[model samples]
Target: MSPPKTYLITGTTSGMGLALVKHLLSQSQNVIATGRDIVSRFPREIVAAHEENLRLLELDITADVDTLQEIAREAWGLFPGGVDVLFNNAGMSAVKACEEASEEYIQQIYTVNLFGPMRLTTAFLPLLRQKTTTTTASSTVIAFTSSSAAWTPLPFMAHYASSKAALSAYLESLAKEVNPPPFRISVVGFECGGCVTNLGQPRQHKQQQQPQSGGSGGLLAKQQEEKTVYGDGLGKLVGMFTRDAMAYMPGDADKMARAMVGVIERVGKQGGGKVPVRLVLGSDAWESVKQKVEETQQVLEEWKEVSWGTDREGVRGGAEGDYLRAVSIL
Candidate 1:
């Protein structure tokens, strides 16, 4: 009999990662869950019960390359056989405009959203390759937790959106490069439209700094800009933010887990064939994706003539200009 397929998931302490981990384990699949605060912040009972299958590895995806490599070595040592699926589920979000956002803020977001996942995936590729080569596996899948925001541009989230967009492009290109038998890349952009997750929490650094209102012109200028730009939308965004502030789901976590498991099993059965690279988890997410696609298509169709540059051809090299050019040359 074949052995149970193994999975290595990052950011397993909360949100979709936690949900995915729980669901995979319930199916009796072996999962190695990594998180920044695996030992301290996580619930004791949860980790204690799943100790056999769940190896708590301390990993901050945003850490330096050397540190990440060390963590990867430790993880590989613990799971020598390698994982069938590597879910890059850890990420972060920023809520400020691109211009207003600090360089540090943008860097932090990219560090977690793009570089961290890329590093982790790169580290695990050898092990994944080994599994495919030795077992004649159909394909090994690497899934990423991308956002709906990746597709649709959103106000005050240029940095977050840009990072996901870059990651998406990178994954798409990487999949093409690694096209070989039993070795495949599957990127799942988990468009969690308004699901409950702790992604809305205020930035830790911002809270620590706590902007003082004392006669600082810069502070007032920022406040004024925020008021002008955010105004009514701020309230709505905040409400949605509060809703997804934790991993808890209004819908059953198990059901969501089942959906993910089904997708993974389907991919496995198909022998590593490409599945829908984008999976909209909830109804809201589906609606949003659909609307955005439709809107984009409409805009493209509307501007097709101008975008194609056919309309400007006559204006650029018409009879009058052709006549002038011919005379001038003579």
Candidate 2:
């Protein structure tokens, strides 16, 4: 067993976030769980039983940066020893065709999925950095629940996937900026596969109090019916999901949470050494990424000449050339 570490997780009202909170508490780790209406969202009995190890705060990640900074400051105060892990796990999605997706809705998704996490991480950086200089200093990690949907092609998930892709890219750039020897912070993105979570439900379905899984079918159908042009294609897509919605996202949330903890523990145990930039959580996610990589490699191979031809004829030994050569891009 590793030493008990403090974890601050966003979006703990339900699904993977809630499961992570419970699993960490079970392991005797301190958890600061945040979400909107957490008192109603989390089981009261569990909260009472783990009062010493758990703290709940109401947070809507879409809030302004100043508000997020305030909450981050408050969270830092809750655990003065400093956080060992900051889990940016809160996310939301809407199920609608790109053509029909409103600008407001699109902006909302970006705010929640991309901008919110970025701002929150900025807010907590000082706190995370504080842990490194303390007498009881230890490795600190910034973890994200980036989705495999970032690279996979799933209809009506374009905006969600785009947001996650941006998040992943941002995290990659952040890892480069931090994680050097003295900084002692590690950034990891989990390209999580589908699990039986409420994420698939469109916002409207949640408003109507429908089942989380398979709830998007009716909404998707209604949208397509009005368009008519997308009728046949949407019908097949809806039919597939209606027949086996679970097939698309079959991983158990509890199990996924456990695996995530295991990974975090391993990274922490490394004593702030190098860790993977991203980890694929489930078999479905692994396969999706694998396929995407292979196809990309094939494309690159086919376009190798054209890609390399774009460079200037006289360009050879400059800084950019040297760096590209070092990485074998030349």
Candidate 3:
């Protein structure tokens, strides 16, 4: 049999992260699982029994830029064969009115969801390049756990949705540019639905530096502009997310983990064949994706004449087709 693949996954403490790690280990695969605290997440018995196949490390995704790079390097050293997949799975959730959330809190959520994950991905590229150079097998994967909220931005979870949406957009473009004609490196956005996880519960939010009352047209101005549009606010969302509601969310964390692992396994099976840029999991998420597509199509159709109106003579649709034919990504 071929050598077991090495996986470096973040946020392995609870919810989807923990579940995925558990599933990987059950197959006797080598896993480098990271959390803010190792002992809190992994059982002592499991760690002891699987010590040879497992490596536990403390990695805070929201740490300073240098700290993230340091831990990533350390993680690389932990697996000499090189990382087959980098699962950017760590994230936190805050439930508050969008304006009520301080600028610092918004920055924090984006750090964990977007910037930090990108840093880790870039840090590991050299190692991934080394793997592809040596093996010439399927491309190395960088799969991030984006949310369906990205496609359908909610009122209460505006910041979270924005962060996830931006993350997905970045990965979509990055996947195309990671390497040119000679190589194919897969970048996947594993868009998970509402899984039963600690993500729904509130975490400590860092205090925003600006005084709540005094801020003039900077952050407050942006907040006011948004509030004007979302004036209806999140009353219904708040009511829907009672404690029991959170506990009764439709997504099962374990099942979601298995689904993610299945994506990785299928990609590996390809041995460098085509892998999808995005996989929208869960029935709710699938429906949400469909809704977005339908609505986008409707809007495009309504504006098609206006859209074409801006175009010069004969090159309306042909321009885009010509560009794609030049690149040939399709």
Per-candidate local distance difference test: 0.63, 0.75, 0.70
Pairs clashing in candidate 2?
none
Please identify which of the two predictions, 2 or 3, would achieve the higher lDDT against the true structure. 2
Question: lDDT of model 1 at residue 193?
Answer: 49
Q: What TM-score would each prediction reach against the true structure?
A: 0.77, 0.88, 0.83
lDDT (Cα, 0-100) at 34 in candidate 3: 82
As for candidate 3, its clashing pairs are: 138-272
Per-residue lDDT tens digits for candidate 2, residues 1-330, read: 656788999878767788888899989999998876666667898888997888888777777889988998888778647678999997876666788788988997888789989999998987777677555566578999888877785886789889999998888878766676567787888888777666644443323321121112233333343564556666777777667767766677888889888777777564645467777777888899999999999999999888878888787633576666443310
Stretches of candidate 2 exceeding 4 Å from the true structure: 1-3, 134-136, 202-228, 270-274, 317-330
Q: How does model 3 score by TM-score?
A: 0.83
Candidate that scores best on TM-score: 2
Clashes of each: 5, 0, 1
Q: Report the C-alpha lDDT of model 1 over 76-102, residue by residue, as the tens digit.
A: 666546667777877766467555677
lDDT, candidate 1, equals 0.63
Worst 10 residues of 1 by lDDT: 211-220
**Regions of model 3 farther than 4 Å from truth:** 137-139, 179-181, 202-232, 243-248, 268-273, 312-318, 322-330
Residues 1-330 of candidate 3: C-alpha lDDT, one tens digit per residue:
877788898877666777788899998788998876566645677788798889998876767767877777788778666678898887765545765888888887788788878888877777677677667756378888888878987666688788888988888878777644344567788877666666643335332111110001111111233343344555455444543454325677778788778777777463646557777877777888899999999999999889878867777353576677545434
